[model samples]
Each structure stands twice: as C-alpha cells, then as structure tokens.
Target: MSGLFVPMTKANGLGNMPDLLEQWAGSRSVARAYGRAGLPMEVIQFPETWIPVDAIRSLFEISARAAGDRCFGLHVGKDMTHKTFGLWMKYSVQAATLRDGLIRANQSSRFQQTGGKVVFVPGAQVSFWRYVAPPMQTSSQVQHCDHLIWPTIRFIQSYLGPLWLPEWVDVSYPRDADARLLEAQVPFPVRFGTPYLSMAIRNRDLSPRTPRPFGDGQRITFDAVRASEAAGPSNETLGTVFNTITLRLLEGQTDIDGAACQLGIGVQKLQRDLRREGVDYRDLLNRAKRVRAQELLSDTDMTVIDIALSLGYSDHGNFSRAFRKMTGVAPSGFRARKDQMQ
Candidate 1:
C-alpha cells in the first residue's frame, strides 16, 4: 500500500534465513560502495525497486561509471533486488497504454520476488494491486510500495504523456508521503479506508493500445556489457572469443579458430587481449567450462559426461579433475551442496 512490500515466496527465496541474510547484506554493501564512489546506486535501485537482481545487475552494468574494486558491484550486487523492492511505492504516472502497461507489469511478476501478485479490483472503476510476499520476521508485508509508486508514475508520465490518468488512489500501509496530499502526484480520488493498494482508472480504458517498437536503441552483447561494467573497454578480446566458443562448445562443437574468426579479429590479437586480461584463451575456455559445468550440475539434472562433452572436455575424468581443481569437490558433491542450500 503506502510502503515497500517484497515477496516472501519460493521464487523470492522461499523465505529462507540464509537467502535473506545474503540479500540484505548484499544490498547495503553495494549501496555503500556507490555512495563512497559518488555514484548513485539508489537512483536505479529506488526507481525500479520491484525488479529482479539479474535485471538490476544489468542496469548497473549500463549506468555506473565507477572504477577499481567498486566496479565489482556488478558482480557483488547481482541479487540484492529483493531487499530494495521491499521499499518500492509503485508510482505509475503518465503510463503509456495505461491498462496494458499495468497488465503487462502484472504478467511480468516472474521478474519479481516470488509470491509476487498483481490484482485488479473493479468496483465502479478499476484498480491495480501488488501483493508481494510478507517479511519473515513479521506478520505483515513491508509497506514501502510508494518508493516505487513515485518513480513508476514519473517514468510513465515521461514515456506515455497524454495517455494515462489515475482516479483517487490509496493504500493501507504506512508511507512517507503525507496522507492529506497523496494525490498531488497521483491526483486521484482517494478512499484511504480501503484494504489494498489500488489504482482507480476508467473501466472503458482497461485495454489500451500497445507501445510501438518493443526494442530500445542500444544493443550491447553480454561480453561487452561485462567488460564495460568492469570500468574498462574491450581489453579482453579473448574473453569475447571465449564467450563465443563456450556457446559453440556448449552445443557440442569444437572450432576454437572459428570463434576467433567470427569475432573478425586475428588469432594473435585475440590471444594478446586475453593475455592482457590476466588469462590465456585456454584458461578462459577452462574457466567457462568449469563455470557452466558447475551451474548445470547444481541447477539441473544433467549427467557429468554430457556436461563434459558440452564444455568440449575430452573426457569425463578430465572434466571431473578440472572441476575439482576449481571447486575442491566432484560435480555430484557440488550439486548436492547446492541442493542443500535450497
């Protein structure tokens, strides 16, 4: 309603203590780094509070201008989104395709913490509802929806001017915005006594036209993003080549030179760039292999040998040994530990 409300479900962390600790520590630490570096982490995290950490990581990779270890928040804060959204306010102003945007946001619940829910209330009008998972230490959901509420409204207004309007809206939870003037931004009729966070909209406008051109302008590859996010440009063409090769290797192919040529760079240049990144092409390939191998083992039911070939490993023994070298355990043991964490 008035305050943030993070989800408390299987998708959000299943309400586990370990997961909560990981997320909470991660959020405060990353934000601390941003402030110390004179960059505004809260600017992005606060605006789209309900978004997932994966998406936020992507955003930091796009927005932050930090260097040094601070640039590493791209990796460290990869999943602190859960804690931040606990403070969102859902301010959707100037939304394009008012109803469609709202509905799509509702459908995109997969991008939020679990137990995430969006509902529509129809009582002489329309209302948008967000019911995130409740906190584990308390019987109630965090009431910071307004953190999102303002920014969301501002974003909609900027993107969808002249297409959206809200009837009086109100939520039941505590919020920082004064109750008497809640409509200054929302400017809708408000019945504060209501039981849910809801928007009042015209019933006839439930289905507005979709926004044109689904894609945004800039298009950067994951490798480019990863490199740029580290506060540097493409100093690691081999990392780029390694990424390409890993994709092919995952598909059970082995054309190392093919990947090098695909990037339109010479073999020597690729090798030199990766070496500058403190790794050789083979080391990167092995790292990718180990990373993917660990992930598949931990997240899926794929067998060891299938993963070995998928990573271009000559044999399962070699794969197992490499995995053990990096992770200090066999693939099966790693998977079991991952499973136990769940």
Candidate 2:
C-alpha cells in the first residue's frame, strides 16, 4: 500500500507552509545515498519527513552514510537492508498507542538515514527535542523539512488531543523560531534557544508504552515483521474520514442535504460509515469544531458569534448551545477561562 505524505510542493496549507523545506536539501543527499545502496531513483521525496516513526528508518540509513566525508556532497553512509528484504517503508506513527513508542522511534530515528539526532529537552515538562543536521544539497528536496516538524505538532494533537496532549509546545532554534511559529501557529508557547530546536510537551506524556525493539533477526525475518507493521489497521480510514468531513464542512454547508451533496455521497452512507466507526457525523463535526474553537479562542480575539459563524453554525445562539454542549462551559465562559490561562 502506498503511504500519503504532505508533499512540500502542495500540502494546501494544512498547518505550516512548505517554506522551511527550501532550506534543507536533505532530500537530495538521501536520494544519492539511496542510489549508492543500489536503488535507482528517478525521484526521492524527502528531507520532508512525516511524524517520526519506524517508517523513517531508511532516512537513518542515509544519515549514517553522510556523518562526515571528504566532501559535504559525498555520501558517508547508506543502508540497503530494506531494499534487500524487498520492503518499502510507508507507516503511520499516529496508530501507536503510546507517546513513548513514538518518541523512541523519533530518537532512534535513522529510519531512513543516520543524519541527525532528536534529543529530549531537559526539565521542559513536555516531549521537547533538539534536531540538527548539515543542509542537504539538492533542489528536488525543496521544502521537505516542513513535513517532519509541522506534521509532528499536528500529529500529537491529532493522535492525542488536549486531554492527553501537551498543554504547550516550544521549539528551540532561533532561525526556526519564526517558521516554527508559523508551523505551530504557536498553539501554546513555542520558543527558540541558542543551540537547540525543541518543543515542550506535557510531563505525563513522555512515559507511555515502552518502545519495543525495531525487529532485527535475520534481515529476511525482520522484513516480514516490518511489512506486517506497515500494513493498514484494517483500512481504518480515520484521517480520510476526518479530512472528508472537514472538506465538506468547509464548502459552506447550508443544511444536511447540502452537505451530503457536497460530499457526493448519500446521507445514509455517511451515517452508516460513521456508525461503523462508533461515531455519528454530528459527533465528528462537534469534535472537529471543538478543536477549532479552542485554537481560535487561544489565538484570536474574535467574538463568539464570529467564531460560531466561521464554524458553520446557523447563528450565535445555536453556536453557543452547541459549544456549551460540546464543552461544559458556555462560549463566553470558555473564552474567559482560556483568556485567564493566558
């Protein structure tokens, strides 16, 4: 199965722009490393990484090849292990049950190349990290870095919302600070430090599932295991469902019929599919609206009515009622508490 990543050239402004990827031509070098490993690539699509996880092992293989060489452009490391086993890496880290497993994979990231280190920020009370590497030297990899970092914060919030999600995240590189701000939109408090790039997470989040060994017996045996892991969770289209609903809602729904028309699917089908996932379309909509509301409240001074209108409620009263039902507090009260926290 093919994996979907937000290509820097056209992520459609999901969170952050593809602006940073231009700076890290890491994709080109990784492609060359792949070539050295004996794979012919008409094109390779990274240094624009997705959420760090086992699927990223190929990148580590490349980094190890490039640690240091007579020339910056020369390959220092290469891994053909995945190739030899006939395995193509395309996995999602969000499916992992615990944040700890995610962090382990990220820290042990040589998923594709052994080029950089991801470290924990001391005393940050979150899943903070410092990632650094020399720039890659290729134009095909333009804007790839945005995929790795932008998707990360979005993924944390996606995989685990504010309840289990960190209250805030801070990045620790001065140069990346502005880009990080745009990437994160500074969801909480993101900062840049002198020698590191980091984002703080909640303290409790760092200790989820203990990371399992990334499967290494004979390369053949490990290949089978890796394939199993990359396999879809039985076609549980969570991201697809979410994106579909949001896209429909964003298309200016005037009613359930209009929304159904926009989705190009029967209302019954939508209802049935959502029921199979143990949620109704309304439930999903409210959940999506709740997240947008929280982010808007924390980041903007929009009136509750404006926020309500923006979220597609018929009017302020309905928005208020729905907001109160989704959250325990009234819209104004929620905004006030959010304001106080600031």
Candidate 3:
C-alpha cells in the first residue's frame, strides 16, 4: 500500500448534516447554526461539496457554544455510519473481517473525512489501530479528534456486530469536559490524557473473521468509489511523497536522490513527475517542515531549539529564519499567540 495518506485538507463533511443537526437537539435553527459557525447555509443544505476539516471542527464549536454541550461530537458521531461516508463505508462494512474493514477504512480515509490515517501498531499482547493527525491543541482540534476516533468506534461495533468493542479507547488530549455522555455510549473504558489516540484490539482478534459475504451490487459500489478516488486528485501520491520526505528527515536522510531511491524511481523521473503536478521538491520539503514545526510548537512544550534539531536544522537560528520566512512570525511569537488562544 502507499505510505500513510494525509489529505491536503481534512475529510469533507458533505453528508453529516442530518446527524449534526439531530445532535443539536433542536435547540437552534439550522440557519442560525450555520451563520454562527461562519459556514455557508447552502453547503450544509446541499452537502454535495466537501467541507474542510477545520469547518467540521467549526461546526462542533458553534454547536457547543450554542448548545452548551461538549459531547456534541460524540452525538454527531452516531451518524457517521455506512450512509454518511457512502461507498467507502460500504467497502469497510462488507469486508471479510473487522481487521479487513479497518484496513479498508484506513486506505480511504481521505474520502471518509477521517482527516488523517488509522494505523495498526502491533504489540506483544494487545495491538491497536491508532488515529494519527496533525497536532494543534484547540477546542476545535479536540472536537476534530473526536470526529476521527468515535466513528472508528462506531464502525467497529457495526462491522463486528453490536457485541464487539475495542479493548479500550485512548485519546491524546485531556478531558476538559464531562465525558459521561461518551462513557455511557462506549462499551469499553474510554481514557483521556494519553500520549496518543488509539483503540487497542486483542492480538488474537486481528485475524480475519468472515462476517457476511459482499453482494454483487456492494462490490460494484466499492469499485466505483475506488475509481472515483483514484481519479479525483493527485493528493494521494503527493501525500505519499511528503510522508517519505518527513520520515527520511527524521532519520537524517534529506537528499532528493535518496528519497527517489526509496520510492524506486530515478531522481530525474521523480523530478519530472512532481513538476508535472506543479510540485517543487524543495518547496514541498519546506511546507512539510513548517507543518511539523507548527505541530510541535503548538502541541508540545518542546523548546524551539529542540524542535529545530528534530526537524534537521543545523541550529535554532536557521530554523527560526525559515519559519519566519514561511509563517511571517518568529517561532516564539507564534507559540505565545497559540498559548494565549488555547
């Protein structure tokens, strides 16, 4: 499979209005909610076009502000079922096993509004499928984290039957609000203020368990979704390239030729392919570095110098210059602003 896919934007919220509005508990008008969130009414009404991940988070913010319920995301997650994600959900649901379903969901996360990827990490006792996303500590981000994790929970229960549950659920962010609403819904213990976000599964349960056979029509729909996504944009390939560069950077491997070799292409071929898609390797590297740096600065209390070294900068001074050039603010200043806002 291609490297872990990260979409250019978080998953779109096209088909989630019914659930979100329902979660609002009729406290506010749809028009008022959209206006409050600064989202277009037509977008929520039509929902044919993809909404940004940020916008989905904004919707939760507005709902929380207007409804005074932090559990809004958990409520909205109830609608993120087969119908919400369309064919992608169908593929996941009809897979041979729960593991297969999670794999299918992981591959199509870009289309599913997952905003990030679900990675299965193996352990000696209990392995887990972890939800990975770009780091930013905001109420909206916390809600977005819920949007990514809770659906996976619901999907597992649906795929393995209602009796199924993950061994446990772990989230990176702290519990800033009452989690009783979520605890009541989940069968397993729900944990907060963890190092990462993950749903641990028993190692033995990772095997394929034939649920139900896929109907011919379901197969057709799955194939069509795959084809549509393949033809939609080159973001998947670009994401793969960016992931490679970032991983290599962490390993102190920063040469285009090395990345080309790892990708099994000649340097010239890699350059030509990226150029065809209007991508510059250096610019892409810079963009990835900027994003990684921002995530570290905002999500962790790591020193600026430490973050710079982690990003492969020779020194903090060079990292700061590049950061200011790209973001128009020093790293310290950015962190201070983010801290105040959060």
Q: Which candidate gets the maximum lDDT versus the true structure?
A: 3
- Candidate 1 structure quality by residue, lDDT tens digits, 253-279: 556576566455667866766666677
lDDT of 3 by residue, 1-342 (tens): 343333334233433643456565563555676666545554443332343345566666666556566665665665665455566766776776777777876777656543466677779989888877654323545555565565676676665565667788897678765677767766679889875679888877667676666545446345676675552334756765675565455444568998787566888877876787687789778877887688778877889999898788999999999999999999999999999998
TM per candidate comes to 0.36, 0.36, 0.58
Q: Write candidate 2's Cα lDDT for 1-342 as tens digits.
A: 222211111111112111221234455664555345322231121122222222122333343335431111111111111122122221223224445434543533433323355565546554554554323333211122323444444334434453343454443334432343343333354443434344556667655542432235223333453443341222333333443344333333434454454344677876676677676666666666776666567667878888888788879999888878878888889878877987
Identify the leading candidate in terms of TM-score: 3
- Clash count for candidate 3 is 1
> Among all windows of ten consecutive residues in candidate 3, which has the lowest summed lDDT?
3-12
lDDT of 2 at 40: 25
Poorly placed runs, candidate 1 (over 4 Å): 1-101, 122-124, 127-143, 151-163, 174-178, 181-186, 215-342
Enumerate clash totals for all models, in the order shown. Answer: 33, 35, 1
